[model samples]
Target: MKRGVVLLGAALLLGGMGQAQTGSAGSKVPLATGTGGAVATVDLDASRAAMRILEAGGNAVDAAVAAAATLGVTEPFSCGIGGGGFMVIYLAKENRVVTIDHRETAPASFTPTVFIENGQPIPFDQRVTSGLSAGVPGTVRGWQEALSRYGTLSLRRVLTPAIVTARYGFVVDQNFRNQVQENEARFRAFTSTASLYLPNGQPPAVGRRINNPDLARTYETIARQGAAGFYTGEIAQAIAATVNNPPVAEGTTLNVRRGNMTLADLANYEARLRPPVVSTYRGYTIYGMQPPSSGGLTIAEALNIMEGYDLSAMSEPEAYQKYLEASRLAFADRGAYMADPEYTDVPRNGLLSREFAAERRALIGSQAAPGSVPPGDPFKFQTDPSYPLRPAPAGFEGNDTTHLTVSDRDGNIVAYTFTIESIGGNGMVVPGHGFLLNNELTDFDPVAPHPNVPEAGKRPRSSMSPTIVFREGKPVMALGSPGGSTIITTVLQTLFDVIDRKRTLAEAFTVPRFSQRNAATTGVDLGGENTPLAQGLAGLGYRWAPTPEIGRLTAIQFNPDGTVTAAAEPRRAGGGSALVQSGR
Candidate 1:
């Protein structure tokens, strides 16, 4: 380990010696280093907490769990135990990659028309805050499973920093304050929420110290009693009650509908270990979360399509066009076929097959397609003639999520993306838990008899693309981002930047992002809109819309010489990346 650390440091120094200056702001962001490990997350305190775990002799999984726990306290609006996520781990010793599905599942009492009223859907605002939006959270169980299966430390030990931060307090930053203030009306709907977030009748001022002893107690119970503590006992009861009988402010008449989740649903929730969606792109193997998550398959399909084009030789505008076309095709399939495989018969094999990609690739031309593209018949390539080809359904997407990437000296890596589904999720906090519950159930379509319709115990499809890349049978990169449906395109763009354009990890993250997603107007960042890439697409009959933000990517890259580089998206405030040398 010590020797590996030395070689890694030397490689980083050499890699940084004389690189050409890029105009991207991320180029100016200093990279953090550690001899024993490295961590990149959206919160500085969370990164430091994870680094402390590595320094204490924990491995990559342990540090990841630690950072995840801390993020719950620090970035509560984005993620917490009340939510669920996916984790992709690269086990260095075993030379294998593993993925864990901790995605929240609909309650057993749910039905296809749960969100439908009369013959139409309920109002978006009411549904967003109502108990009907909560799912059986899977985050706590996921953390426990990862730790027990691959970690070097106990849950009690790994959760210490988060527990301390929640009990004592952490300073609120401008970003956090702004989020709170923006959602003040929603927070005001619940007494428990307002008490914790809007203390003294307003959102905590920037840099103000905030504490949540109740949340600390909840973590304490989990530490002492394991996953059961959160899923089956007092905490579980609180969660159920909050969802089934939500508290409304006086005279507010929320008219919110109750959810069907019971204690039994919470108790029965189990995180699964699933096989990752694997595909090869330019000699590198990409692994991502499978069904219940459209990220892996969509990314793989996009890359396969672009592989036929010489992206490196093409002008910026040409490359962007190819990317937009690929995204359109993949998202069309996402709406048609992507869903929870346990409940739906998704043509997984056909979707990731190169031949299937070729069939779809033939649809793209020098000109952009008009309006939203329709999904293709990939199932036609399936060997199973008896397989059911269900009709695909369109569903809403969410963007409030967080991601963390970590790599230890031992070579193990973790790429995890978790979320509460929306900002201040459901606007309901478990009475004393000091955390927000996810609206993941809304990810399902309100229509009946569709692939993505709500169903008993079915996991909602997600676009959180927790991913890992390998070269020549060895792990090389762990990457992911948070941006709802945009996640797939964001990751696809960055991968192309690094692999085809030969940009550093920072440059790849800093580049302006763009996405089409089968929509009539392509969404581009401010910079992308002003570039020739936009004008060229417009000349090809494409309409463009400017997006304020696209993704918050956290990525770590491992060089052949043993050195590792990690970075958090520069676009997000409070983002952090740090590395610990092997001999630390």
Candidate 2:
């Protein structure tokens, strides 16, 4: 933990060099809007609607909930009310932070064997698809809870933008069309799905104006009736009726598979607020969503391991070597120890302890190995009883959602990330819902006894890292990203860029990104690790990642001068935004 400060100083020293700065590849700053010393950024126009609520005097909670609802329409492929996620909030009035774990839970009827095939385990791909894989959705429930507690806006008011977008029409973009085209085959597999998506038996071309009148109507119902309208109201009944028929209609969808889904599942679902996992490195505090999520622990472990080295003076290659070594070690701990705390007794504290971190740091060598093995730790056997085991066939590799950062002059901030699993999710669309259902259930480990095995109502482990940093009891940064597991790494690196390297928010985000999966024993897979500096690090103990695995990141910095400067990952169309109080 002591290394945090040192790393910062090192970054600052290096940043002061005459190295020329480069623009990010696919990152952009998000559009920001607010007033009275507050600012917010979201991925789409509707998200801005949520920010408008704050501008109109709503609090952080209200703005976040509004932003979430708006995303259901504008960023449907990334997130919607049908999905589940986590929320990290910094409450200015209370001077405290709370993490809402509205993450999806396994249904009671869920069982590990559901994914097995012909008396044997099924492949990860098959498990990632199909109806049996769906968990109880918490996206809407979670946001609603946030609104209830911290927002000042009404649900109807907050949801208005989503309603308007769905009712009329929104122009399709290249990314939108691309997502549809990519999933065309699977989308055609379900009749109802085909009716909604394949109106011409093909994806709409980019720039085409597409409309979902049904989804608009549904949104209106939801706004008027609250979450009840979507879960137990006519919308739920319509979904049930449609699900009873898998065939598609000429102009609508009936492709939902028949199954055990009942109104009870929707009505019974509720998002819970869980304590966040908190740790301090040097003088900075890092907080993340708890288990059923790997972000906090994995990030902490990586940082802990890195703390053991003096990476500042090392050349790029040397620094890269040490970074990769630390990541590898932490990933090993993540694979062996990380899981849903509700399902297993994860060693949350010990893993973050200074003594444990120091011991783990001692194991890294200056030479990098071609391939990696799980780092050994003697503490596992001595501390707690391990959870039941499942033979995880080499864990499969993968993938983002979208992120939003919000803050007010009062010091309240919210760092949030949302997703619909893969690009188009399950490719199942409810008539009039104007969005896709999340395949989030697929995030659960398909193997039995893995602690993350499917159970009705059990939330799967997620890589989403929505974080807020505090300094001397004041909120300093509210940031998060869209990369699956890579989200944590991108976020951590950005934190280093900000706190240590002294880079501006935009400059920090422009730095190239890299990542490793949830599994242990593998080096990071970099999407853009081919830089001269990164290449240099490959010579050190760090083995650079291969091509195409980096994740996108977006962040907003609340500077000491009261100005907010934001930056979005250049790898995507998204851009970051900032705001300042007029007097400042």
Candidate 3:
């Protein structure tokens, strides 16, 4: 099996080809048709809902919140109220860039020994599932905060589409069906999950009308009462009681039972909004999520390193070789110094400085550095790993996520990425909430000597890089994706292809891309692990897995004339781009 491809007992394939529809069941009608409107989301319904809100006097911020809520309904497997995420909003009127960090945080009761076994590392399976793996969810709180400060629509209105879909039901698109089938065993293993995800004793087929009344009730409660409904109300109580009160269900795969998770964890959770980490690459200013998320710094570092070389003149093989080298350097620094700024002393400013970036890039030779080049000296970043190095090897843990971009005619833009942190997270579902809790804690290293090693109440490093681009201090594009650690590279590459290489939004996304995250997952394997693209990279001194599959990416760029251009990844279905014309 290759990286980024779906792997499970059910053998479900991603990137399936099918006819596009207008979001209505079996209708060939297109969903978006406008000039000034653009939405890039995991599902067409989700995107259309946001655009509709924008059409109805909602600001970009308002539309973004609604779009995010809608995604929780139509694309539940990837993201929902059970998860936490990040958002980048460019407030046009204020001329400000704000980043909301609602990324999941460890429970207050979390301990370093949580995943340790007699002071040794725990097995992958144990570290992956159960209540212990879940973090304090912040999706609801995050969305609410974004709306309260920047939006004009009431929570009730912004949440209506999601509520309607959950109550009335909607067709189970092929992508949804495939995701369910792929994780069937995990879903079946837990009684709570089995009851809801497998309502009819099996996952629904494509076009099957699937209604989640439980989720509807939960959404209704949240919409009416605000974020408090999901955090401290009946919904929260039910979740805490259900998982902790288990009687050893028949098909459970977890060895440990119950574990400590208090309702306090939910109630005390709060999402914070901070300024985005910004850097200039060529003429475009890039804005991405700040620390606690290494994505922004790593992207800036990689782009800066790549700038040292004249990649355009290099052959395909040479270009790939340099790309891998630069990525390795970035990953090294990320592993060594990146962490949640609230908990660690990360040098945020230094990481994005021109001097540091140029110095880091100078280490890359014309050829592939022998072995993995360690992070260069802090001052100069030498190309040789035989010299002083950074941290030990990074681990490979798969996570699933969704991305959305919303922009209104007023020039406000919001780019967002949300995730459950893994497919069928913890393989457990909140009893009646109809969503899976995230396995985000697994993102922390189980062993020591790694900067992101598990710690009490510490946020793990993440790659959910919701980003925006500015030209002459004005928002020009908004994009993000669900590619696990590959997210930073993919988003950065797409932005480069668009602004630097002069590719259209669709063309930039469709163009062959490469990624390098470490030895376990690198850009040299660009075609992905099991595909022809990987084979091609392998022939060029890159040791990619035989399988070639890369992560799915969705993006939208704004044309100064007010037209919106968008592109959706084929992995999650609904790849066609939609544009909403200005109402004026």
Ranking by lDDT: 1, 3, 2
Each model's lDDT? 0.83, 0.63, 0.70
Candidate 3 stretches greater than 4 Å from native:
1-34, 246-248, 251-256, 377-392, 520-540, 546-548, 570-579, 582-584
Report the C-alpha lDDT of model 2 over 195-252, residue by residue, as the tens digit: 7767789988776777777676776676677778777977776554443343343453
> Could you tell me every candidate's TM-score relative to the true structure?
0.93, 0.86, 0.88
| Candidate that beats the other on TM-score, 1 or 2, i.e. the better one | 1
Residue-wise C-alpha lDDT for candidate 1, range 1-584, written one tens digit per residue: 13343243233222321121122112223354324477788876677667667766889999999899999999999899999999999999998889999999999998888888989998777788999999999999999999999999988778877877786788888879988988998899888888889899998998789988888888878888999999998999999999998877776656767887899999999999999999999999999999899999999988988898999898777777888899899888888888898988888877878898998899999888887887888887777653655566556777789999998878899999999988888988898777889999889888777788899999999999999999999877888888888888888988988998888888887677888888888888766777765777788778878887788888888877666776786665545444444311
Model 2: how far residue 25 lies from native, Å: 23
Best by TM-score: 1
Clashing pairs in 1: 33-579, 34-579, 34-580, 34-581, 35-580, 35-581, 35-582, 36-580, 36-581, 36-582
Evaluation by TM-score, superior candidate among 1 and 3: 1
lDDT assessment of candidate 1: 0.83
**TM-score rank, highest first?**
1, 3, 2
